[model samples]
Target: MAVLAQDGGLAFYGEPDEAREWFRADRIEDIYLRLAEAEEHEWAGRFGAAPAPAPGPAIGAFRQWVLLTRRSLDLLTRNRLTLAVLLGSPLMVLAMFAVLFRPGAFSPESPSPAATVMILFWIAFGGFFFGLTYGLLQICNELPVLRRERLTGLRITPYVLAKATVLLPLLAVVDALMLGVLRALDRLPAMGWGTYGELFVTLLLCSLAALALGLLVSAAVTDPAQATMALPMLCFPQVLFVGAILPVPVMAAPGRWLSCAMSNRWAFEGLGHSLGVERLWATGRSPLGPPLLDSYGDTFSRAPVVDWAMLGGFTALFLVGACLVLTRRT
Candidate 1:
């Protein structure tokens, strides 16, 4: 069988000359020379170069990566509690509050139900605090395991892609639930399909930004205890600086600069603006103020600035930084 293995599909098994059909001619010659030299180093019973392994389907590089990604996602799903908490807690809390508070408190007119739902769900639930909790948790939990898997030849990019893919659906469900509750309570405006698309994009981007930062920290940190200790420091400052509760322009100069560095600031600003909260702020009517861009007082005002742009930029920075750290040789 071993002999037959070397004859057909395994024609290149031990002979460099056989490699010509599979590899470039020059490459075959170079491999042949190396094989010949390696033969000299063979022990009493061993061949210098072991027979080449059998090839399978001509899967492309991306297809191989997808397979790897699917494997990682399968592993993640098996850890149901972790996945559930990571994706479910925020939505659960939001629903609880909507149940507890009078629907009128969140209206776009006063505290606008639409405004409160958008802010708490997207900005507070998914943005700053989620980044702190989920980001740190994902890293502290996954980094070491991933590092071991990577050392065994698994690709980091595929793993990241898989994890991100698994996360998106959960985020979508959360966004939908919150959006549904607000709408059912008559808190949201008569949104067209476009509004749903915009909200999904904004929330997903926010989740990615948080997830990336968490992975970056996980890859960079040496200890899990230290990561746990650091999460609140990362989260609390972000909440204070993101203008969820305060106007960025009104902050002390140092605080303003701090807000510039906080992903939460951009997220809340973008989400707030996208939901028409900034319009109130702009027209000097909102409890919060000095929104990042143009604001109007119309009931269904367009954002003075694009929220997606800020979210895209922040998410890109975090993902790139995380990839760099994850792919670095350890």
Candidate 2:
């Protein structure tokens, strides 16, 4: 290194003062500048030949997944208010469910058909709500950082998957907790583990679909406030068209058509099928059973797998939509 001074004096760098100058040019600045440049290059030379190793394709994706998921989990856990709301929501909903529904709604000999329907519907809605609320605020608030990451070779698929990877487990736990608490409280029937497993799967799928929808919305919106505003618009249709409030057969023609698009409808019907709500309503002691069953028509008659498949389809569609929205936004 070399520098020329204002006075036209030159100094040689990259050498001890007592040693021969390493460079051919001696048009350096002052002695202080020469020493500084020499010190800088001496340090730089140590690392100049060594470039960062590139990770293999699979390993690179796995590494990104791990890091992104870790960062998301850290941010989620550190926000005490957010953490409380996420975990507390199920408990609060459980409390309301506990208060609203009396025990043995699923009791075969003396069933309360109305309570059973409400229970299944609300559980489905709860799963949907949990997934949606968690995902809505996730991407919108991080747009600036996400844009910078995109410039640094961040893959959108892995980036979006990481959000699911972190959040889905939490959703699983909450869904399980919702069922366990309700069952323990006799809000749900004494079904076998297999039945509970089916219920859990249905609820989890419902949550996954909602999560994907929320991610799509989050990626579409520009900020958290917009995301917040989107919630009611996203939710109103789910609540109204899910066939919980009004049986699908009884809903107006357009409402019935829109009900086909709501993931919660599948989930609720899945739960009902898993618990055999149709049979219970048809044969149970409650006089209310037959009338409600007539209103619901064949809603819960289809196999739960069909509903599961629908939920899975919704998840895939929403995920692809989210990815497209994000790619376009970027």
lDDT of 1 by residue, 243-290 (tens): 545656667899878877776555555555565654444454444544
Tens-digit per-residue lDDT, 141-218, candidate 2? 998999988876787887898999899999999999999999999999998999999999999999999999999999
Q: lDDT scores for all predictions?
A: 0.58, 0.86
What would the TM-score be for candidate 1 when compared with the true structure? 0.66
All candidates: TM-score: 0.66, 0.81
Query: In model 2, which runs have C-alpha deviations exceeding 4 angstroms?
Result: 1-59
Instruction: Return the lDDT, model 1, position 94.
Output: 66
Best by TM-score: 2
Query: C-alpha displacement of 40 in model 1, angstroms?
Result: 23
